[model samples]
Target: MKKTAQIFAGIRTPFYYYDMEILENTARQVKELAEKYRIDVHYATKANEDARIVSLLSEVGFGVDCVSGDEVKLALGCGVPVSKIMFAGVGKSDEEIFEAGIAGIGAINVESVQELYIVNAIAAKYGFVANVCVRVNPNIDAHTFRYVTSGLNTNKFGVSESEFPELVEMLAQCNNVKFRGLHFHIASQIKDIAKVTKTLCGVANRAVEWFAGHGFETEIINLGGGLGVNYENPYGDTFPDFEGWFKAIDENIVRKPGMTIHVEPGRALVAQCGDLITKVLFVKETEVKSFVVVDAGMNNLVRPAFYGAFHLIENLSAEERPSLPSNRVYDVVGPVCESSDTFGKGRQLPLTVRGDLMVVHSAGAYGQAMSMRYTLRPIAQVVYSDRINEAEKETPIL
Candidate 1:
């Protein structure tokens, strides 16, 4: 913390600080664990998509999982091979489909029947066989937040059982489409490993059997990544339990011969490696409560305002003092006009004053990726540890 504070002193506030060491370590662990089981791992691009991070993951031998056309192209720009990229999104545009077909991406996870037809048409136009995996709605309740759950029957993600038969029939008639396998993504931030693994195993096994009965062989079974991380205690559990996570899948999922397993991990891989550093602008004390207003707002990091998520708040300037030595409760907020732009309701911290730097922990995943120019605020700049340290040692912070 002291080293980071010195390295970033006088540079700028409201910026993202990425510890490259943590990110590389996380990637290494995920890769090592996935390789142990021969499981194919794809770094979900939606997680960070920072060119540097994507290039690092590409170098680490991890494929990328892109959601939209822009992300697909972004991954390509990051030098991820077309064969190492899998595009998955429910509402892909015609241009996106055409581009994916032209690029010959690894697999497009077809979410709906209409998308299937559209993809097939685009592939036919391009004279290329589109490799696609049918995203199945397993109806498994990941028991995660309602907003993030995608595998529920009511969600608009995958095709239902009744719709699957018709989709299979349509696939049989299409000359430009090749059936690769089935895809299942319950949701994001899933904490219950047993519940998710058991449910995924049941759905995948049944789906494989049903497809075989219809004279189809699945080459890949993608268990969409929804693994959760410890946001409340990011330092204690910096990395998600990848060993236990893969163990659950390997022991539960009934694999077919020559079948490949793929998982798209987003949050679990990148969430803990980043922190949002915002400077305290004003310490307002009112009759109602004390509010610490920071220059950063929801436009900078919206997880708190958008999802009511909790990120550990630390006053790096007060690291020398005992934890919350003052024992005073304060509402840490941002400059955004929205009432929901509150980071923590009643955060207990040490005596804080103007210009004190605060680090919002566990922000690497959705932090900058979801940032917007709302309220006409310029988005925060990102400062990487590896680069900033070297430069800071030679000169002053910029």
Candidate 2:
């Protein structure tokens, strides 16, 4: 911890610090475990679209799972093979669909029958056959936050099972569209292994039989990744139980011969490899409580304000000065004008002061990707730990 603080003392505050080594290790483990089951893992581009991160994953041979046209272009720009890209989104624009069709990417997960028609039209215009996967809403409760849950019937994602007949008829009518497989994503941040596996098995089994009965042979079944990471204790569970999760899926999902399983993992792969570093500006004590104001705001890392998310906070300076009494509680907050800019309330830490550095763990995934310019706060710069060692100059906190 002391060495970590020393490393950050030279770095600018309110910047994203990524440990590339950890990222590579996590990817390697996930890749190994996924290969053990012969499953294809696609790194969801929405998580952390940092060029270095994207380039590294592409070089490592992980498929890119894109949610938008820009993300598709980012993967392509990062040199990810078109055959290793899978595009999925609810409200894809006509232009986006046309772009995907023209790129001749691996597969596009069609959300609705209308989207199927649109994609087919674009593909026919280009004189190409567009391979598509049907994103089905299994309607299973992912038992996660409502904001992150995506598989419910009420959610604006995936085509429901009730629309299967219509979807089949629409596919049959579209000559330029080829049905490749089915995609099911219950939600994000799913922790209950049994719950997700059970729901997925039931859905995959029915989907296989449904396709078979319709005289369509399914080649791939994409079980969209929702495996949660340890936010409360990122270090303790930096790398999620990928082996266990894969084993559970293997034991549960009955697969047909030559069928391939694909997973789109976003948060699980990158969440633990990064931290949000900020500097304390003031420690204000009021009649009700004490607030440790930091330079980073909700615009920098909004999980706390957006989803009431909890991240492990560490006082780096306090750790260095071990002589200070450690029994102090403060509300770690940001300088955003919004009242909800608080990161954590009643956070107990060693006695801290202004100029001290604070580290917010488990911010690698959505932290920088969701940043905003609200309040005109500067967007945090991202620095890789591996590169910091090469540059010896101190970076002033902006």
Candidate 3:
């Protein structure tokens, strides 16, 4: 990124920079591995949803995993096939369900028995059978953040084991809803393979057998994506363990004849390829600590404020001034009014100063996608690596 900093110097501050080559390579890796394991991959559109990123992944033959009607439309607009789109969300509105039924996407992951009835009713009203998958809450702990854990009984995501009988009865009665298979997503940012191979796989197998006993044959096991990326050291292994993840599923999952396995990965595919570039606006020194304030704020990248997440931060202009101390501890903060607008605390970097370029790594997944106009801040512009020179010529320096 130091080499790229030269190009960034001429552009405006607080913008998202995406490395399309890295995204392409990561997409290719996922495609090759999915093919090797004969697993269908649907890129979770909620991760980034940038037109360039989505279009590239679509061209790579990866389907889309949508959670909203707008997201489904966005994926379709990005050239993703309607047959390749899978819609999953707990609170899908009636309009959304009607749209999905009309569009005839691959499958709609139903989270509750009541939702199954609703989907069936909507499909019946539209005179088309909606392909549906029951999202089961296996109650497995993925050991991730509390907000991201979705498989627990307490969470409001999927159907619990107690609802199996009701779900089976409902599926039997719903003529307009075609039972495709099952869906299980324990949590997001799952780094442990045991969570998938041992915990999730075991529950899914039992659920499939239970459903089959009740006259529903499982066709697709959509393992919702939670594969984690290396946020601590993204530069080391930029890619997530797609190979290991697929291998584990291939070995552990008990696939029935003519049944297909599917995965919906979001962060693992796009996180490493992007960075949030911000220029230090002030270097404030207090009695006990030092702070490096940047123009970017929680509205720009909310992971730090929302999830208490970490992204590797670096001073890209450090090498230019060798006279400065190599080790300097300071709190990296944003200019937002809220006290939670901090990026990192007690971070060690080369003596940072005003005008120094700072890069936040592993932000491609949730950074720009989750950004808002909170505090009335203008949304940051995106600059792709392949078009850096063009962006530099177009964007005037602040």
Candidate 4:
């Protein structure tokens, strides 16, 4: 294992620091494991939009899965092969579909039959035959955050079972469209093996029956990424047990001849190696509650504000304590004006003061990608372990 300090223990706070060495290890593990079963894996770019990160992933022999036009462009611009890109999203506009179709992408994962019509029309306008997948709402509860729960029957993400008859009729009308397969994405942060297995079995059974009636075999079965990580111990558990994750599903599901299995992983692959480093601006203590106000806020990382998500907050400056660092609990807040801007409430940590350094673990995947410029707190630099020495001169935190 690579030493954390040697790579990048601290050079800046209020900015995202990524351990490239850890990511390198993670990519190797994921690729080697998935290759064992001949599974085609696509790294979802929605989790982290950094072009350099995408480039590294491209170098590691992986495909790209995008949700928007810009994300598709980012993946391609960063060197992902056009033949290996798949587009996904529910609200894709005419322009977004137009752009992806024109890019000569591998396929577009169409969420609704309405989307199939739009994408096919766009491809027709471009004089091209586009490959696409119909996203099926299997209605399997992913047991994740409500906001991220998409496969539920009422969610607005995919085509419902009730719409199957129309979908089959529409597939017959696709003269300029190729219905390549079916896709399903349940939710995020799911770690239970049985839950995923049940979902896989359910999709396989449904699709097999759907195909028998319609004479359209599922060429690809895509189970979108919702794999969870150990945010509290990012370094120790950066890699997921793909053998269990993939094997469980593989054993449970029956694939058609020459069927391709695609997985679009974002957080599970990239979350652990990232940290949001910030400097304590003020340590305010009140009779009612204590707060650790920092330069970072919802603007820098919104997981806390958006989902009431939990991330491990640590005092890097207090590393040398004889025992564990200060165990006192306080609200780790930012400089935002909104009451929802706080990162965490009653967050216990080392006793801290102004200028002390704080490291918020697992800020990599959704952290920087979701940052905003609210209140104009200057955007922090993204430090990668591979180039930390270069960023140090330019992004040295006080």
Q: Who wins the lDDT comparison?
A: 3
TM-score of 1: 0.96
**Candidate 1 regions with alpha-carbon error over 4 angstroms:** 1-4, 320-324, 389-398
Off by over 4 Å in 4: 1-12, 320-325, 392-398
TM-score of every candidate: 0.96, 0.96, 0.97, 0.93
List the global CA lDDT of all models: 0.88, 0.88, 0.90, 0.81
Lowest summed lDDT over 10 consecutive residues: which window, candidate 1?
389-398
Model 2 residue 289 lDDT score:
93
Please give, for residues 278-328, the per-residue lDDT of candidate 3 as tens digits.
989999999999999999999999999999999999998987787989899
List runs of model 2 lying over 4 Å from the truth. 1-3, 389-398
- 3 or 4: which has the higher TM-score? 3
**Candidate 2 residue pairs in backbone clash:** none
- Show the lowest summed lDDT stretch of 10 residues, model 4: 1-10
* Tens digits of lDDT, candidate 2, 277-387: 898999999999989999999999999999999999999888878998998999999998888999999999889899898999999999999999997898998878877
Worst 10 residues of 3 by lDDT: 389-398
Ranking by lDDT: 3, 2, 1, 4
Q: List CA RMSD, all candidates.
A: 2.4, 1.8, 1.5, 2.4
